[model samples]
Target: MIRFGVIGTNWITEQFIQAALESEEFALSAVYSRTEERAKDFAAKYDIPNLYTDLESMAASDQVDAVYIASPNSFHAKQTIVFLNHGKHVLCEKPIASNAAETKAMIAASQMNNVLLMEALKSTLMPNFRAVVDNLHKIGTVRRYFASYCQYSSRYDAFKQGNILNAFNPAYSNGSLMDLGIYCLYPLVTLFGKPNSVQAAGVLLSSGVDGEGSMVMSYKDMDAVIQHSKISNSYLPAEIQGENGTIVIDKINQPGSVRIHYKDGSVEDITVPQVKPSMHYEVKEFIELMKSGRVESTVNSHANSLAAMEVIDETRRQIGLVFAADLK
Candidate 1:
C-alpha cells in the first residue's frame, strides 16, 4: 500500500485524510503542523501516530511513501524539493510555484529523484467536468469559454482595515486568482491547450494584492475569459458557446452540475449528483496514482501542471504581481 502523509490541517486536508482511510490503495500514516501543540491535537483527532514540526524530519520518515503538501503557496516549491530529495513522491495544491522559474526547479527535483509529483486540481476530475466533456458534441465547434468564480470574502473587510490574514495577503501568495481562478484555468487547459496569448488585468487593493480580477486567454479562433473575485457574487455560470449550442456549469470552481442547450431548443441536464464533496475525486485519484507507482496519470500529468503554471506565471507577470520573497 502507498503510505501517505499530509502537512496541513485545513478543511480540505481533513476531507482528503478521511477519504484515504476509506481507500484501499492508500494508508494515512502521518501529519505535520507548525507547532507541537497543533500537531498533537491533530494527531490525536486523526489517530496519526507520527507528527513533526520540521519538514525534513517528516520527509525522512519511512512510514510515508508520499507527501501531500497543502501548505501555503510560497512553501510549495521548497517543500516539494525537500520531499523529492528524501525520495518521497509529492502531491501539491494548485499554483505549483510562486513563478515559472521556481516551478521548473521543483520539476527538476522530482524528475531527478524519479518520483511522482502532481498538482491537486480537483476541478478536472469531478464527475461534473466529465459530464461537460462527454456532451460537447452538441456544442459543435467551441467558440468561447468563460468562467467566473466570485465570493464576498469575510476576510475582505479585515483586509480593508489593514488586518492582514494569510488568505488575503500577497505575502502568503494568495488572492482570488491564485485561489479560485486556478480552478477555471485547469479545466480550460485540460480542454484546450495553451492560449495563443494571454492578457491579464486585475483590481489591486491598497495592500498591493489582487482584490478581484479577470483574465483573457486568446486563441486563434476562440477565447477564454476567466474571472476570480473576492469582492462580489456573480450569476454568470462557467460556460461554452458554439455555432449550434451552449453549455453552462453552475459553479466552475466546485461545479455541482452542468446543463447544455442546443440550437433546436432542447435543454439537457448533465449534472452529476454526488453525496461527497467535490474534493473526493482528487483524493481518490491521488490514491490511485500512488498505488500504481506511476509518476503521473493520463488525466493529470506533470506536463499539464507545467502548462497551467506557465499561464499563471505569465498572468502574474502581466499584472505586475510579484511576491516580496521571490528569489531571483
Candidate 2:
C-alpha cells in the first residue's frame, strides 16, 4: 500500500480521503493543517495516525509515500515543489497553479525529483467523460462547441452584505473564472486541441475578482464559447455541434449523462456509469502511475495542464483580471 499524507482539511480534501479509504492501494497515514487543533481533529475524524502543523516535517516523515494538496490556489506551486523535492509524489487540486509559469516550475520539479505529479482533474478520468471522447466520432466534423458551468455561490450573499470571503477574494486567486470556468475550459482542451486565439469579457466585483465571464476560442473550422458565473445557476447542458450530429453533455463538471443527436432526427444515450465519490478514479490512476514510475498522467497530462493554464492566462489578460501571483 502507498501511504499518503493530506495537506488540507477542506471539504474537497475530505472527499479525497474518503475515496482513498475505499481504494486498496491507498492508506491515509497523516494529516496536515496550519493549526495543531485542526490537524488533530481531521486526523481523529479519519483515524489517521499522524497530525502535523509543519509541512516540512510531514514531507520528511517515513509514513508517507505521497501527498494530496488541496490548499489555496496561491500555495499549490510552493507546497507541491517542497514535497516533490523531498521525494514524495503529489496530486494537486485542479487549476493546477495560478498561472502557466508556476505550472511549468511544478512540472520541472517533478521531473527533477523523478516522482509522480498529477493535477486532480477528476472529471477527465471519469468513465462517462472518456465515453464522451470515445463517441465523438459519431458526431462527424466538429463545427462548434459550447460549455457553461455556473452555480450561485453560497458566499455571494455575504459578499453582497459587505463581507468578502476567500472564494470571491482576489488575494487568494479565487473567482468564478478560475474556480468554475476551468471546468468548461479543461474539457474543451481535452476534446479539441488548443484554439488559435481567444477573446474574453467578464463582470468584476468590487473586490477585483470576476463575478461572471464568457470567452470565445477561435479554431480553424469552429469556435468554442465558454460561459461561467458564480452569482447565478445554469440548468442548460453543454453541447458540441458537428456536421452530422451533436453530442450533449449533462454537466460540464460531473457529467452524469452524455447523448447524441443525429441529422436523421434520432437520439441515443451514451452515458457510462461511474463509481461513487468520483475522486476514486483519480486516486486509482495516481497510485497506478506512481507504481509504474511515471511522472505525469496520460489522462490529465502535464501538457493538458499547460494548455488549460494558457487559456486561463490569456483570458485573464483580455479581461484585465490579475492575481497577486502574476506580479511575482
Q: What's the lDDT of the predicted structure labeled candidate 2?
A: 0.93
How well does each candidate superpose onto the true structure, as a TM-score? 0.95, 0.98
Q: Candidate 2 regions off by >4 Å?
A: none
Top candidate by lDDT: 2
lDDT of candidate 1 over 260-304, digit per residue (tens): 888899998989886666666877787677667777766667777
Native-structure RMSD, model 2? 0.9
Candidate 1 wrong stretches, greater than 4 Å: none
Candidate 2 lDDT over 30-84, as tens digits, reads 9999999999899999999999999999999999999999998989999999999
Angstrom error of the Cα, residue 267, model 2: value is: 1.1
